[model samples]
Target: MEHAPMSDWTTLPRAFYQRHPTVVAPELLNKLLVRDDGRAGRIVEVEAYAGSEDPAAHSYRGMTARTATMFGEAGHLYVYFSYGMHWGSNAVCGEVGQGWGVLLRALAPVHGLALIRAARPAIRRDTDLASGPGRLSQAMGITKALDGADLVRNDRGVRIACDGTAPPPEPVVGPRIGISKAVEFAWRWHVPGHAHVSGRGSRSR
Candidate 1:
């Protein structure tokens, strides 16, 4: 299927992310995150992590080598490693000096199910292909290799692009999942009724 034209990086100004975390979180759903392999994945869920005030956000500690990208220009990809076994993806937000990030929590396979399944043979169902942060990263072939990459550029072969579709209606929002801090932030956002949303309360919204 023909996808929507990609979003221009220039259009995503630094101020865009500083406005409201919650609104930006759900607005990202259904957008396409394209990889160099000619495959695209539809974002299904996201979590907002504001500046230093958000305890769960890496920027909470100020700038570190690991989080410097989150403070850079907007529209950059801030990838990190966790659990000694998985990688997580985040989108940079706010001004160059400000720290903000939008964690990509899950995805709905769009244009590369066969490739994703080949990479993850253990997945027995379509919904399982990219239903969690780690799973989505793995399925999309993302890793530390992509740390600090620009999501609005194709140089890395793993840039995020728009697929010309608006997000689902009334995305659900609740507390972020799998974190010891800022558990009450209620920043997680996802398509209200998508079967692939990760974590609990998948149906409550």
Candidate 2:
């Protein structure tokens, strides 16, 4: 894993995540989530999980060891296991102990197509590489090990950096996907017509 140059790239600060989950979600668009090995994916889709108040959030029922990272400081990764098989990741938002975070729903492969393809052999087209939360996590080599990593640092195993990208078409909002709980909550946000968005929310979005 090599650290990419900071030229034209700036790690997003913690203050950027101090707002509400909904506010933080759409704002992540176009930022590059770079892995230590130089694999970078441009964020194009996301879902906000508002703490305690929103039933879909892991923090809704209160904090456990598994949900502890969601309650930790902002600007950290909150990777988790899902469906008893795959891993999914989120960028923690809101204040420390707030438990709000934005699920990294999808990405447009940017920095390492070959590496991401090796990580996900079932993928034939590049658009399918990170079209869902679990696939996004797997494609980026993110696992439970980076559950609480600081995404605001350049030296970390994974970091989210600004790339001066023009914002995608305005985000489209829809109900949260996959989970049965709070299925009606319109918290999912994604770039309209972006091929990288997950299947679960496409119809509604």
Candidate 3:
């Protein structure tokens, strides 16, 4: 499918995210996720973790230093330090004050694979590159430095671009993995049968 020319990401308005959760999740697939390091990638998988209403959502507990980004303006980056070692990236959604985010679970490399590999040499197979949230952030050089950066424009150095290519029809949604709560929500969305989807059972989830 043809893609939109690269342009500044215009933060999606509040109403855009207020729509049904599942609808927004798969719509994000195939969008361009570009980093300042000249490395750009495509979002292949995502998980919509809703507001406090969703037990599994981080915002379920209210505001904290780590989750504050999730509550901010729409289209902002909500990055979090995890596992005492890596960072995960999410895109804040919903109304300005509602505190919702769409977790960018995995990416399909489209540009700068060499740079990604140089950063994470342990990723030998092509499928492993940017296959998980933490790994994708590290591989793409997304860190605290980029926390709260605007995804709507390049002034902040990195931004997501709409490629105009709709995600494949029939994305699969199921229980989110590696979470303690809301596991029953079945909120994760991924390409139906893509090999690069990060986790085991990705096809099922």
> Clashes in candidate 2: how many?
1
- Kindly report which residue stretches of model 2 are placed more than 4 angstroms away from their true locations once superposed: 1-6, 200-205
lDDT of candidate 3 over 120-204, digit per residue (tens): 8987787788889998898888888788887765536777776556677778777787899877777788877776688656445
Give the whole-model CA lDDT for all candidates, comma-separated. 0.78, 0.85, 0.76
Candidates 1 and 2, the one with greater lDDT = 2
lDDT of 1 by residue, 46-83 (tens): 99888778888888879999888888887778899888
Say which prediction, candidate 1 or candidate 3, comes out ahead on lDDT.
1
Best candidate, TM-score-wise? 2
Model 3 CA deviation exceeding 4 Å by range? 1-21, 202-205
Error of 3 at 106 (Å): 0.9
Over 1-205, each residue of candidate 2 has an lDDT whose tens digit, in order, gives 3434545578888898888989888889877888878688889888899878898788898889999999998989998899899898999998888899999989988777889999999888899999998899999999999889988874357888887775555678888887778888888888877778785534434
User: Candidate 3 clashing pairs?
Assistant: 3-163, 4-163, 9-152
